[model samples]
Target: MENKVVKVIIGILVVSVVFGTLFFWFTPVKDGKKQLDQIKMNNNYLILLIQVINRVLKLAILTTMKDLKIKLNQLKFQIVLN
Candidate 1:
């Protein structure tokens, strides 16, 4: 269930990134200063989005590692009993 949720979130993020890139490229700005400012704002948002994705990935990795550790300990306990 968690894996499915993560995949959905990642899919949505990828789609949004593509849409934002297209919007930014096609947007028309008559004022040079305004365009520069808008581009900078978009860049900041992109950076933030990237950071969020990285954090999610890190969380998934940590969770998997914890689960593996638990299973390894369980196996070791069983081996010792037998």
Candidate 2:
């Protein structure tokens, strides 16, 4: 009975190892490389979008400042009560 159990256990281990080796050796490698490339492209697109938004905000702030300066120059301050 003990010999039977040992043989069964060894058989199970050998089968498991064979399956594991086949899975690792025969798996497609291109799918992983494609996924990595897609992630990198998405990251580059996001960076470009952020840079555009920053440029637009800078232009708006500068225009607002110019308008404010012009309004300040037009205002008159007098302390005379007559």
Candidate 3:
């Protein structure tokens, strides 16, 4: 269902972000200063990307929760009838 699909998408995004952060932080590099400078230069872009991803994650979770609530209510109503 749509709820399952949304949950899967959220899981995938969360996993990717975790691995990406680990790789970004722990991966070996040749020049520390140069790497630092590069990261500093791209900081704004990184912040923007993180913000966009955060918004997407929030929206996905909210919709999934809403769908789940609707499904739960339907089930409850069915049980009451039975």
Instruction: Please tell me which predicted candidate would have the highest TM-score against the true structure.
Output: 1
Comparing 1 and 2 by lDDT, which wins?
1
Of candidate 2, the 10-residue stretch with the lowest lDDT total is: 73-82
* Superposed model 1: Cα runs more than 4 Å off: none
- Estimated TM-score for each candidate: 0.80, 0.53, 0.55
* Pairs that collide, model 1: none
Ranking by lDDT: 1, 3, 2
Give per-residue CA lDDT, model 3, range 13-77, as digits (tens).
67776776666666666898978975774565457558867877788778878988988999999
lDDT of 1 by residue, 1-79 (tens): 5667777788888898889878876788899998998899789878988998898788777777888898899999999
lDDT of 2 by residue, 19-64 (tens): 7556545555578887676666656655655565566556556666
The superposed Cα distance between candidate 1 and the true structure at residue 35, in angstroms, equals: 1.1
* Candidate 3: 10-residue stretch with minimal lDDT: 40-49
Residue 43 in model 3: lDDT:
64
- Alpha-carbon lDDT of model 3: 0.74
